[model samples]
Target: MRLTQHDATAPTGMRNNYVVMRPQNLSVGVLPVHDDGSVTLVGQQRFGLMNYSWEMPEGGAPYDEDPIDGVKRELAEEAGLAASHWREALKIELSNSITDQRAMAWVAWGLSAMPIAPDPTEIIRVTRVPFGDLMREIARGSVRDMFTVATTLRAYHMAHQGELPPCLAKAMLASVR
Candidate 1:
């Protein structure tokens, strides 16, 4: 990460120095949904927030690497799951006012077991929660990770918009009701 300062002119024609943070590498997040409308979540102590967070499997990807490959790797490493189908859900600028850190998220289904290979720096715990329950937790502020929140909301939107298979959408939407 690098910090730099630049001049900014306000609407009132006042000038000031704007300090900005530039972060290296792009980030990827994946929401792995099972056929039963359950989604896998990973829990770990986040250094940035200094709190335990339950979030989608997420990690940084080199700018030159395909984000999907990073997403696939994170899903396997953090959740021990693989998906047969994938859909890009969101591209977000995290803390845009402060940093140039960007993230891409995906919703993946058709899950099967894989070998877990967590990062040496992380101790991850995984759980499968029903989609509606996950939504409720987000609403209750138990899950505050932006990547997970945005992707899960997008999946819900996709289900409602008929972007997903009928059976899968039905199963997913049914959980919310």
Candidate 2:
């Protein structure tokens, strides 16, 4: 395989300037969609926060495993539900304070309608929240799970052009706080 080299000193255009070593780990994610137009999310106590907030379950992609497969595994491991139908959505560079990683977004539907076996390290509750509540959460800036809110809203926009379920839109309009 052919690879390009670039400079490390320049702030950008590193593709033609340098080659950096990759980290030892990777991550992938998915937003499980519900038939009723809601989404299955999770809540966990976060840093700089008093309590938990809503977010779709997600986690790492295993070595050599397909991103899609990784997302399915994450769903089962994080939410305890097996994912079936899915589609590729977006791929983004997840840059955080400590590391740079690739996180993929997927659209998964047709849940198994059964219980999940979440990871022991995770203290999360799988919640079925209507879009209205999520929109309100966004409006109030109460959604600490920025990824969850952004990805799901984009997917919802993709599915319905920002016209989420009618009740949700009505609620969003009413909750102008």
Q: What TM-score goes with each of the models?
A: 0.95, 0.70
TM-score: model 2 vs. ground truth: 0.70
Off by over 4 Å in 2: 1-8, 11-23, 47-51, 96-98, 161-177
Candidate number of the best TM-score? 1
lDDT of each: 0.90, 0.65
* Residue range 1-177, candidate 2, lDDT tens digits: 133354555455444345443454466777776666566777777655666767777777755877777788778877777656776666776655334566777767776765667776667877876666766777778775656766766665655554344544343334233
Model 2 RMSD in Å is: 6.0
Indicate the worst ten consecutive residues by lDDT in candidate 2. Answer: 168-177
Best by lDDT: 1
Q: What does the lDDT read for residue 152 in candidate 1? A: 91
Error of 2 at 138 (Å): 2.0
The candidate 1 region of ten consecutive residues with least summed lDDT is 165-174
